[model samples]
Target chain A: MASGRPIQLFRNMTAKIAAIPMILTALVIFVGGTAWTVVYSFTNSKLLPRANFVGLDQYERLWNTNRWIVSIENLLIYGICMLVLSFIIGFVLAALMDQKIRFENTFRTIILYPFALSFIVTGLIWQWLLNPDFGVQNVVRGLGWVSFEFDPLNNSSIVIYGVLIAGLWQGTGLVMVLMLAGLRGIDQEIWKAARVDGIPMWKTYLYIVVPMLRPVFITSIVIIASGIVRVYDLVVAQTAGGPGISSEVPAKYVYDYMFQGQNLGQGFAASTMMLLAVAIVIIPWAYLEFGSRNRG
Target chain B: MANPATISTAVAGADTLPLDGPQGPRPRPRLSRRNIFIYGTMLVVAVYYLLPLYVMIVTSLKGMPEIRLGNIFSPPMEITFEPWVKAWAEACTGLNCDGLSRGFWNSVKITVPSVFLSIAVASVNGYALSNWKFKGADIFFTILIFGAFIPYQVMLYPIVIILREIGLYGSLGGLVIVHVIFGMPIVTLLFRNYFASLPEELFKAARVDGAGFWQIYFQIMLPMSLPIFVVAMIIQVTGIWNDFLFGVVYTKPDTYPMTVQLNNIVNSVQGVKEYNVNMAATILTGLVPLVIYFVSGKLFVRGIAAGAVKG
Candidate 1:
């Protein structure tokens, strides 16, 4: 079974040729690009990228800038609220839909449809819905609650929450679908056994079933969390970091500096921070999933 | 989708709908206090989900005069196709008053080729990894999948530079390549798992019959894998269509994709705000993916579930 030229590069010539794009992308674009951004972030490149070193100056300015600070804080608020609310809403909806209710397809379709639309569309629709003159504020006020003030788009403080509403509206549907998938994956015998033991369905779900769906939960969290980090278009379409940059997110900050501001160094620094944030979330998940699998 | 009810009942083992069992009059299940609670809450949540879509449609149909009287929840007094017409052919972005036609065409150009090229490349890569198994293919595969999670911002400038170096910067072809690059990971993971799941004996049989790598992939793997290809198609079409950041970054303003241009039209500050036109444009931009979502139905779910599990 000895092969001639054991490690010859072109053994399977077409296969090797077919793999060139993936190889180039993995090596040059993804790896090279990320490294380039991190390195350029340390330099004083403005408008055009250059090798002129600046020794943390961009990072210093990014941190000191009010908009950047506000972006982080908006991200935190949007992240935490979106995280907590979407999960709760999603899990609850999944649980309810898990019931032997009628019209499940219709309900599921209606809910999941929003997940199809782009965030830009989501933002614009919500922008219209929240408009002070024609939106929820006017409608509610028209409904006899004349003192209603639900204009989060214009209000600086809760403008993030305004965007959060639209975000949740668009996102929770996917979360529900994912959770529904998880719920459906639960073994039926557990439910039968719980019923035989006289355990209430709620307690059965809370105490027994949720833990079994840990992988699904982890997947949703990672999906939702990564989504939270890259939430730029939604903000752009909805607020454009409006009424004095109150709802600016880190991703938007990165975009604005790099392209709009033409401050390449600053954008690189900001994007590097984004990269760091994603790494924080992804590294542990990768290790937990793959590391133990390798040995086991 | 093979009867949604049956699928749920099979998965959930909860066909306990009282008094309405379709198969032979089974004893009615007890109507517990819990039934009402479960459904009422779901109705509320469903309404919350349906609100924006309902509002968008209703708002888009109403005339600008009614929109000024603007109760978004109300149905239109007189439905008008004028806004749709305006959005599709007459809406303005800066001095470009030619409506969303430019962006729509630009997106069509970007999405079609990007989808085909990305899927073609990824499926082949997946085939090679799963079947051919070169000396270091898995290493590269690992790095490629890992790269998916990195914020595009980190890769954004570098991609620009790379595209520029390759003489594709700010061009439609360059944007197409960017979509292909970004779409590679999930598409590859999808096809790899798919191809690997096939019976190994087929490949062995084909090999003994003198089929080479390309021969097997082209003759065997592809024809058997059409459904997975459709699923991959659904994922890529939706994803690349919805992408804003890459389109905004990689393409010039004149060639911006629909989502980017849609954002510009709705959020552009210079114009006297036209809510009806904005709503019309919003729906027009979303129409492609939304239509796909409705038509593809169950496959859309399968695509996302597959994407979610791997990605």
Candidate 2:
């Protein structure tokens, strides 16, 4: 086991060489780049990232900006609605699929196919479907229900909900798949014992199955939460943050400021907030997961 | 084996519980109430999920005049392939009227190298981490895993600066590098876990035969790791193909990948909206990933599971 110092330095040299890219990406890009952005957020960088320090001014302006406020509001509404609805819908679909039903693969394929498509495609498809003139409203009116109204895209008050519809259509399949896996992992004996004890299926699921699938639920939430924060392309494709910027999200706000609006300071500040939002979701989850494992 | 023991125990546990219903097999109907509820709910949800794809195909096949007068739900009276051709050849994004073909090829150019390079780099890194445990490797690996959760926006500009300084900004090469950088966390995790799960005896045996790092990787590990390589490919192909943000941020107009180009084409405001052409373009942009998904089948789910369930 005793080796010379020079030999130790040269040992596994191929590995160290191969890992250079990972090292650089982890150290320089992920760690260093994040630090650079957080630092630049404090400066009044316009069009270009400069060393000019203006402490907290960018964040103050970011808060005061109506567009940023709207983006944050839309993100919250979209995030909460997406989280709750996706879990409910995903769990329900998964449970139904688990009912020893026929054509389970076919139903699953139909539901999960949308997850294969990009957000852009999902957005465009929904935008056309929600077009008031030729879409759902027109069809209903032609069917003799002339007073029906179902347009959400053009209405500023409900545009974010419109985006939410497309978001759910594209994403809930992933949640369903994850939940289905979790359900399958449960022991069949649990269900049989419940049935023998005169417990209804619903009660058994509520009491026994769901709590056992807690890890899967947490994983689904983490995946969905990160996705909800990065809700950019769908907005850009469907509404283009339209109806007077009412559907703008934080990701879109950052993009417009950095690339289009030429306000790097604001972009950095907004994105820094995005990073913070992800941390708030991730840090505790990571601790509970990895922390408990190490201790046990 | 353990299976029979567990099964017998489970059967005994079920028998110990008090049964309220008849013990023997009761009269069971094919269309029972529970069956009706489950199948009916599943059918309704399936229709809702299928509606958009159905509408896309129907709308893409219709003429503009038909699209204007007809309901989106109604079948097209006249099927026309004109929209498909127009979407592929004549759809414009800014001054370039050459359509989605340009963007499609650009995506290919971007995807192929990005997938190969990232897999090569990550597979080796994973092998090294799992087998050749050097000093500080776990720390870097931990940082890499944590990096996946950091929002990409936080690193966007500094990457731009880095790319600019390295003279790869606004080029396809630059976008490929970006994909590799972001893809590192998940793919490395995939490979690392996979290699770790492989029997340690094989690796140690090769080492006893005086096999070095690269030699053991190429001679022993590579042959055994084909399925995981496919999983990584599936992840990268769909991911790089579906990407919009990186493509938009990293490349110029001529070099913009399909997603960005498709967005510009569909959302452009200069002319009257061509719904048929726009739908066709949308489908075109999505076709690559969709095909990969259908073809891969269960592997697609495995890819998502691998990417999602991080420890």
State which candidate has the highest TM-score. 2
Q: Write the per-residue lDDT of candidate 2 for residues A141-188, one digit (tens) a residue.
A: 999999998889999999999999999999999999999988989998
Against the true structure, what is each candidate's TM-score?
A: 0.94, 0.95
Scored against the native two-chain complex, candidate 2 gets a DockQ of: 0.78
Q: Write the per-residue lDDT of candidate 1 for residues A1-296, one digit (tens) a residue.
A: 35657657668778889999999999998899899999999999998999999899999999999999999999999999999999988998899899878889889898899899899999998888888988999999999999999999999999999999989988888899999999998877788789889998889989998999888888999999999999999999999989888889999999998888989999999999999999999999988888888999
Using lDDT as the measure, the top candidate is: 2
In order, the interface RMSDs are 1.1, 0.9
lDDT of 1 by residue, B1-311 (tens): 23445665574565555544355433345565676777777788778878888899998899988988758999999999999999889988877889999999999999999999999999999999999998889999999999888888889888888789899998999999999999999999999999999999999999999999888998999999999999999999999999999999889888988898888888887968878889999999999999999999999998989989856
Provide DockQ values for all models, in the order shown: 0.81, 0.78
Lowest lDDT block of 10, candidate 1 chain B? B19-28
What level of docking quality does candidate 2 show? medium
Where model 1 places Cα greater than 4 Å from the true spot, the runs are A1-7, B1-32
